[model samples]
Target: MCGRLALYSDFPSLACSLKLPLIKGELTPRYNVAPGTWISAVRRHDGSGQLSLDTLWWSYRPPWADDKAPQPINATVEKVATSPYFRGAFAHHRCLVPADGWYEWLAVGGRKQPHYLTRRDGEPLWFAGIWTERPDGKPGCAILTEPARGVAKAIHPRMPLILDQQSLEPWLDPELTDRETIRHLVHHLPHHELTHWPVSTRVNKPEEDDPALIEPLEPSAP
Candidate 1:
């Protein structure tokens, strides 16, 4: 599960890189983002085929009658097509959550050591997500997840569903509804394509949002 992440790219740079239309307001860098907060997301509307980069609440709440617990920050792709809570969004509200890197905690000597994972070549990563509007009219999203691979497996059991430029068109295009196509896209990203390094525990605190949180820390795994 991707419980924490960091987005350091300036909005203008990100917009240009992702070919997203310019957003009206400026976006500040977030180095210690946690669940249930506003996050930057790229959404494509089906009818107009237009892309919009906007901020949305990080957790999604379903339309079920019961006032159950807040929806999960991430959803499993296997159950998405059939789950009542996520089927609608899976079909219509697909989105992309962009970030420079994400934080994962590794169990070392019974202590949690934070690690920063990013593309090996240092490119920004786009995580597949589903979004929806609540009764109060606020937008929210849930990241998708799959089993971890390669180096990430040593740290955690699951990783975010990351998509590359080649997959972005298919993932974002509303016309493709077949579950098989979407399923094929959820598998592990190339192991060689990513790199991870230990980072300061400063990231453990949600309020510690800054550039330094991503800086490499020594062999402080314990």
Candidate 2:
């Protein structure tokens, strides 16, 4: 599951990559973004075919859901397209979550070890996502995850569903709603372009958001 991530590129840089209009604001470089917080995403929530970079609460619960309903941060590929809690958003509120990279943990010798995963070329990655309006009227989202591939398999059994660059527009195309049609047009970013390395456990603390947290852990460190 993808619970933590980093996005250091500013609005203009992100806009350039997405080819969308500028949002006219700057965002502080975030090296360790955690859940239950606002994060940037590109989406078209209405019939108007406009895409905007907006901050979304990194957890999801539809407006109709019960007050005590759980807020999920990641939606599994196996169920997102079919689950009652997610299918609607998956079909109509799809979005792209930009990230420089993400963090995952592995059980190593009875302890959890964090690892940083990013494109080997160092280009930013885009995570497939779904959004919905919360009961309080705030926009919320959950990242989509699929079975891990390549080196990511060694770190975890699942990873964020990173979208291929060419699939971006098709993914957000409001007119494309059929599950089979959507799946046929959109594709995951190739696993070969991604790589990972062990990092400091400091990332385990939501409060510790800094560049040093992504630094490769020293061999002797526990």
How far residue 62's Cα lies from its native spot in candidate 2, in Å, is 0.7
Residues 25-130, model 1: lDDT tens digits: 4477889889978999888765777887888899888654245656789998678777888888888788889898999998878789899998887777889999
TM-score of model 2 (CA atoms): 0.95
Model 1 lDDT, residue 112, Cα = 90
lDDT value, residue 95 of candidate 2? 93
Task: Give the C-alpha lDDT of model 1.
Answer: 0.81
Distance from true location, Cα of 67 in model 2, Å: 1.3
Which segments of model 2 are wrong by more than 4 Å?
A: 20-26
Ten residues in sequence with the least summed lDDT for candidate 2: 17-26
Q: Any residue pairs clashing in model 1, and if so which?
A: none
